[model samples]
Target: MVRKKLYRSKKKLGQAPGSVVYTGERPKEKLFLEAFDFTKDTYTEKQLTNIEDCFEYKHTETVTWINLNGLNHVNAIETLGKHFDIHHLALEDIVNISHRPKLDDHDSYLFLVLKMLYYNNSHNLVSEQVSFILGKNYVFSFQEAEGDVFNPIRDRIKNAKGRIRSMASDYLLYTLIDAIVDHYFNVIEVLGDKIEDLETDVFTNKSSDNLSIRIQDLKREILRVRRAVFPLREVISKIVKNETNLIQNQTSTYFKDIYDHLTQITENIELHREIIGGLMSMYLTSISNKMNEVMKVLTIMASIFIPLTFIAGVYGMNFKYMPELEFKYGYFAIWGLMVIVFLVLLFYFKRKKWL
Candidate 1:
């Protein structure tokens, strides 16, 4: 009986009011808030529960970063939108999980979308959409969940070790984007390791169900990485060119750094694709070689049996040979002659290296 094949779909459900929309099944509601207020010499971080509390420090001339872990709270989003004068479409795109990685510039703010990746416990790659709205003084980030890969950047900002916290919102946006792009490198590293393991298996072992599944999985991951990373280069390119004053000249340099990173990532993806193609070829060649070996063995067995079958048929003829019937040891002589013929053929085949 043929078995039904199962596949995972990439489609996601439509966004609903006060819902956490993702590119997969419905996710649970999880909202976390982390606020960072920093200047040249002092910094403060606080985990906030109410969005109104964030307004207290909004106009303090400090670069305030408000990170919202989930976008399911429509009221909070609306409140922030009214407070910061965010464009309606930018707010809508924040709740819409299906938005591609892009940059949309409004007169007062810049809307940036990106995909964040992490290796899950099952060693499979997972992704989430993160959207950024850069205003005059505050930078708001909306993500699918808390505890993103931005912890390192947060640490750096907290320690006052970098020029990031002292810079404008554009630089902060660059740091956030740079962190996300760097995580792509991490994801690619995992994929690279998987490709290496697949290469080893393809060369040393016959193609099995598991091996084929692995190759396909790796291909899917590479495609996913491509989708997440390829457009980011354009995003950075636009930023570096200073298409919008949202990114200042000094901040454009940081965007250039991100552009270089994206270039390296794109190159890595292409190289991994070549590696996957090579593994596929190796798999096909292995199968072909095995089939050829089987055909050779079958051909040799048929060749050896053909002559024996003919000799037996001749000896079993209904009309016996008169001279052979008169001899008492005729049967023994026939068997010995057949043995000699078989030995000769075996020797020939061995000499020709066809056995």
Candidate 2:
């Protein structure tokens, strides 16, 4: 029997902020705040401790990006929400952790939620939720954990080599979303390599219990990837279609580019799924062919032995008047005849190609 290694565990769905359950000494969730303040030639970054301190930096002419790592601090989130005039529901969804990938326009702000994925050491798929609130001057991001897959974007911003950081918050949001989508390509590429390796092994070697388990795991991972990416297409489409002042017209082109990448990733995922399905069919066919060969060999051996066994049984019957028993050479002649019969049957089977 195969064992399942990855599954979702049950947990409290909705808990109120400040409830003992929320404050109970769960490991202190790391909250990393990285600020990128940039305008054409000038770029500055700071690690902020409190969201309130960000209010001064919000209205600056320079585009500012405030990235908040952990959302466990309800007080900080509420303060940030109030400072930015973010809607209550958006704040609620920001910390919900289970919110689906989506985009919403709040007139003054654009709220976006996306799922970030990575393969762990065990080759199991893992995902985290990322929430973004884009306003006129500043952009705020909330993640479930501290570390991000966005380190490259940070490096680009720091080097001041790219227009990404100097661009408006909308462009920063685009870069961030683009970076996440790019990681999908990396993940799916790894999955494609795995499928290729498994295909080679399936054809060259017999299928084992592990093969089925690995196929199922790959299928599940692809499904998970699809779930994460499919909704993003709609999210980006909405950004492109809706004429939001928050997302500049020029930046809309970048969002369209992201949409294209999402489409490519979706196609790649579909192809991978088809390949896995083919591998599964091959596995079944191989098992059936092996079983058929075993049955054929067994039938041929049984056919040759049945008549020989009957002949021996007849000679073994006890009878005082048996003529063959009275002849001295009869025993030797019987053995010689049996040998001839066995040789003829073997020759016939060989000629028929049944051997």
Candidate 3:
């Protein structure tokens, strides 16, 4: 069983606040930066390996989205941090991917840290830390790795399929968060299917030796997901409640929609956890019942054989002057008597429902 681990904050224990440190995973993939600039009537996209390419849109009123795929490159993060004038603490949080789901509100922008969930090819649940800085006319999205669960939002921007192109930076932020939250549904669906298989294995006559391990793994994953999603409600409500001016009134409703989805995800996770717990209890109970049935059968056989064993012992005794042993019909008589005794005991036991 995998237990939930406490985020060890020891790395920053003696360090000063705003000190930048990479706290979570260390990836080997090279960093890739993608910039999307769009408006109600215009759209532009670029893929640049250099951070300097994004500097031109730093002060522009045209909504620009900068997505950096890897966080292992600390120098690259510092360059963008300098350009945007992002606070040292925000930069620190960006690099320290272990930071939980939280929102840090500043006057010019809102900094948010989120957990992006995805499933690998093996259907194992994977979590990546994604941080966002929502500025007046620009937003910076920092991710821990190259591939992401944001293809829907990318497709939307590429195809002009939705109102996202016409929306402001805050709406774009909400839309992107919604995209990440929507990925949870796929994880849940895949896990739900696995749970169905586990249910059969658990309830079937043939027990799987690996059932316990799979249950523990699933439970641990569910708990991890719940931990990531529960705090997201507060993160979105901070926006909906307008704690930061970066989120406009019109865009607040969209955040509320995201909050609703987070709520549904949380409820589903909790329900699954309950079912898994019930399955555990049922497994134990089923084993107990099986043992009891076996014991009852053994006990019944012993009861039926006790008197017969006594009669056999009485006749098998070594004695030379026993009167019954000398009689010619003694063997037949004893056999008839033993048969009568067995039938009478059988009848009594059957009547008492113990047969």
Candidate 4:
């Protein structure tokens, strides 16, 4: 999904609380709505072209899932919120995708905001906001885009392969959230692979020129996942502890499972963060050791040349001065002496293990 800076803009600044504003990067696209109504004995799915199409499902006896993609359309969201009796604040948070994961129990429904994580086509982690409103027989889901991690749930509902079709809307909510949480495993696995690759590069001295950059990017990705996954733990906890009739006691067990998954995900995120930190330090140490090696070689070369340079300097003097210079074989003698000194120093260096 295309993303923009989530920082609030002047458009929403100073606005009344609960004002519905589109704070996401997605452009004004036509909203997509899909309705799934199912019970133990029956199932139906519809591609709703009109927002009003799914409005009647609110009164239906069967469990209904009304999913809307395209929070950029404030009018549609507001209309749906009004039809469903969703609080203005809830609608506000839905469009303003910056809200962290949270749960608000309303008189007639439960409003939940969660960060949906997935790898986009570029294989980059993307955090999209998905809001859920759970009511008597209906659950409303809002998103910034069309695709989601709920396809498996859809298949389950369609094929009647699981308890989802026979369960209440609360179970449906659990499944949806479970799907997102399950995808976290996939995302974390990808991140783990990346960390291993970078770790190998750092250890084997085969890292790219942008190794630091890659490590920093990995750090950022971990942090982003942290921000997305940590708060969700609390959200699931709230659901499990919620006294609202919308969340059935049996369904609470499923939510508790989600909480456990979030805990695991958070732990993995923290571990990855520490690993990234270590990778950074290792990279710096490697660079420093490499520089030290270069300097050591340079220092040894200078040490070897010092005596040779002195001899050359002494002979380079203009004065005819020296008895050594006056000797007939001085040139050959000097050459032999310098060669012997060079060999002696070389052997000494070898013996000292300095070479």
lDDT of 1: 0.81
Best by lDDT: 4
lDDT of 1 by residue, 230-348 (tens): 98788878888899977789889878888998899999999999999889888888888889999998998888889988988887787865667678998999898889888998999
Clashes of each: 0, 0, 0, 0
Question: Compared with the true structure, what per-residue lDDT tens digits does model 3 show for residues 1-355?
Answer: 1122233366667889988776655657688999999987888999986988989997887899999987888788988889888999899999886778999888988899999998988777888889999999998999877788778888888888889988899988988898899998888887788788888878884566777788888998898788789998999988889888888898998888898998898889988999899888887788788899899879877877788888888888998888999999999988887788788888887898975
> TM-scores across all candidates?
0.87, 0.88, 0.88, 0.95
Clash pairs (backbone) in predicted model 3: none
The candidates, ranked best first by lDDT, are 4, 3, 2, 1
Total residue pair clashes for candidate 1: 0
Kindly indicate the candidate among 1 and 3 with the higher TM-score: 3
lDDT of 3: 0.85
What TM-score, to 2 decimals, does candidate 2 have? 0.88
Error of 4 at 74 (Å): 0.5
Alpha-carbon local distance difference test for all models: 0.81, 0.81, 0.85, 0.88
Model 3 spans with C-alpha error above 4 angstroms:
1-16, 319-324, 327-349
Against the true structure, candidate 4 has what lDDT? Answer: 0.88
Best by TM-score: 4
Error of 2 at 104 (Å): 1.2
